[model samples]
Target: MGGHFQGARERPNGPRQRDGECSRGAGRNRQIHRGLCSPSQFSTPRVECTPTRETPIARRCPDAPMRVAGQPQARSTVKSTVFVVVLVFSLIATGADAQRGPDTLGKIKAAKSINVAFSGDSLPFSYVGEGNKPAGYSIDLCQRVIAGIGQAVGEANLKVNWIVGTAAERVQMVATGKADMECANTTMTQTRLKDVDFSNLIFVDGGGFLVTVDAPINRFTDLNGKKIAVIKGTTTEVRLNAAMKARLVNAQVTTINDGSEGIALLTTGAVDAFAGDKIKLIGLAAQAKDPNKFAMLMEDLSYEPYAFALPRGDAAMRLEVNRALTKVYVSGDIEGIFAQWLGKLGRPSGLLAAMYLLNAIPE
Candidate 1:
């Protein structure tokens, strides 16, 4: 239930792009559905859902008898209430599906390479590693996905074209078939699912405040009037705003391009606090020139589930990615990855690992 997500801002080079942008399908502008893109608009263009039986209908009926035609008699009444509930729930589910991006798997296959988009800045999850190559948990997971594709196509060396992008462009890359997969710290939210598909939950993240060691704020409720730093187009922004609104708290929000810029602002005292995912904040803090100057508040505001994103139509691709993640979780590779990248502060507990294991599948 914890993760990171990027933004929706345009890149400097006109709009951020990968290999090439695909055309947008109708009803493709809604928020994500079920933590992925709309099923109708597949970023991969290679997947389709064949309907199957769902949960059994819960049935109820009126207990009271009514007189009809001037006669008192017991009559069986099939209540319309059940239908109403079903209709309402179905609409919710359908609305979620409508948010998914169109199928793009066919387009991706024709293009030959399975293009993957990722945030070039989210280190240890998706970032520039040695040789300026994309490396992190998501990157490694994608490598396994590439292996699956090689097995499918009988190409041992299936090529993976890595495209560096921002949070704003991640979905568009998949939605338009510019890239077939997204390997960033993406959160699973209903709004994002409408535009692209997400793989299994790769990591769990919680929202917290990042502040200078000397700052006075120590709790989620303490962010009043204080300029809080946040990234644009991310769940951190959405949830922080929502929490503030719900709690009747007010704070000035400053949107930055990346964590580095955000830390710069904090270091210069341009803002009172930096708000983001705890893991990411810790990463930034560890790499800071003087790590002792900042600390993450222990109190959390929300939990988010991070997952890999793909175009909605590519169920095969989604499944393949999920399978690889499952292997990582079951094989204990995820633990190792966390240790290598995030375990310095503290090793993830049995509870957190159990949660990851239980909800390993994509929503």
Candidate 2:
């Protein structure tokens, strides 16, 4: 009972109890005085003083007497003073508990695990590397994030659970409590906000097409009545449909589970075009059998702002993620990450660079 709250009868206007140990009574009193006082009321005072004269305590037992030293000073007043002191202590204790941060970090520390989700196929963002382990820009960034989380939570050796899945499943995993973080290339969109929360925009990308360099498809309008390969549950899927419809192109969409599948279909002439974010197309092109065979369509159909997704209710996790992103953005580390994974194309324009600098959180 070291961390226990005060008893019921000791709480102001709480229900009368035989021994005043009702926690429900304290809860009711707390609800009533939710904004009535501050959290410091129960703290031990720095100064101490003795009463010069004892007065009769109000609303107390008549038999009780107040004594300052060996001599009796006042009788009834002592009981009232004791009740007031107990009430003040209870209020302060309750407020302190209410202000305490959530134990998410503590839970991770105790369990020695940090679960995360990564897109299994989004190259340069998140994908399998050597030994089939997770790698890519987001994967690297998340490794640093996990390190920061471990340091902050005092779990330096925490085990990591790297869940690999499609982009669609990545968001659902984190949103449904199956994973703590989705270090995938999840775009920050209004629709995703319904079930998931996003950290600040970590990377920016645009929906573009990757077609054979000699193919007839030069822009969005050139793919009329063409077979377009796209990954399901991505902004590129939507953009493909929208652009096709707007340009009066009769496009047949083939939704693949991974980038390699899409590229394979395209290479075999099964699909007339492959649609994805420009950054992803670049990464995929680098891995293709013939890197020089394909080219990204200059016309971007849509913009996708990439971010890390966390569970909706975990505000502390969200804050830490934002802190990490803001740190990299301000420190100009993103340029290095971009260069490492995306080469020169990943560099943002002057406007976006200024935005990142402006929104960076100060330590």
Candidate 3:
């Protein structure tokens, strides 16, 4: 029949006929006289309609839609999967960019100069010397690091701008990018590492009390009910307070601005004792009006490990700084540098010598 039928098949060649043209007959006698007939319309069919490679589904059934229906959920799922993949890649790229951070070496190369923050009062480590220029043990080490930086950037001579400030101020300068490096008697501590990085250990010292010769204090226990002065915002100050509290010493603690001020306070009898790094106190005592009148207690309250402070998270700049420091330690040039500024101290102690030996990294 020419009319549509469900699950129907068509003949290969059939006589043309009008719609619904079929000969009526009894039981098995009915037949299509002159038109296409569906195999499903008869008990014994002549042909079947199965799609194959030679005949696609659309070709076999011309009324079928190109795309199958009722799959909107699947389409949405594919889009969501694609979006997640793209987002993951984007986050990875952002994290990589964040970790690469600022280029400190490139900035130094472009400026052809480096700003070094130093202490103008911490004698022997960093301080104002003859002609009002920065000079000391830490300054000598920083010069070598600067030279190494110059070679790394292909500059023969890089101008160094020495900025004078206190120890705490120097650390802030390096952290804020106002200074390239901080050359001072800055101690490397767990607290300071959060804001700034440090070079390899350059010097080691201990906190002690520097008092007038006539003072009644002979040991930490004698400092009860006495006044003591210490440089403000220094590791020595923090350690001094801790030590006093631990020892139950009821001494009055005062804060001074620098080593010079601490010395003045001790000399003027404003404080019974002055607490500072042992080596620094020696330097201050040696420069006092009456050197013979001052005596440093033969006791160390806290350990101090000194290093040069650099900007935090700058691995390349730190590598160069350490490389230069390692070279100085390896070549035996550190001896001369030490004697130039601290020769009056006799010789480097066993502890200090061990520090130099341990930090001498190989090329």
- All models: lDDT? 0.72, 0.75, 0.83
Under the 3 Å rule for N, CA and C atoms, how many clashes does model 3 have? Answer: 0
Residues 96-196 of candidate 1 have per-residue lDDT tens digits of 88765354444555556678888777866788878988887677777877786666655666667888887768877877778878888888888888887
Clashes of 1: 45
Q: Per-residue lDDT of 1-363 in model 3, one digit per residue for the tens? A: 244223323333334322332333333323433233345544464423222212123222233333322344456656766877787799889999888756788999999999999989777889899999998999999899999999998886999999999888989999999999999899999999998999999999999999988888889989999999998889988988898899999999999898888888888999999998988899888888889999989988899999999989889999999999999999999999999988888899999999999998887
Worst 10-residue lDDT window for candidate 2 reads 28-37
Shift in Å, residue 147, candidate 3: 0.3
Displacement of residue 220 (Cα, Å) in model 3 is 0.8
Model 2, CA-based lDDT: 0.75
Residue 53 of model 1: what lDDT?
A: 22
* Model 2 steric clash total: 5
Error of 3 at 165 (Å): 1.3
- How do the residues 18-60 of candidate 2 rate in per-residue lDDT, one tens digit apiece? 2222123433221211222223543433111123322213422
Q: What is the C-alpha RMSD of each candidate to the true structure, in Å?
A: 26.8, 15.1, 12.1
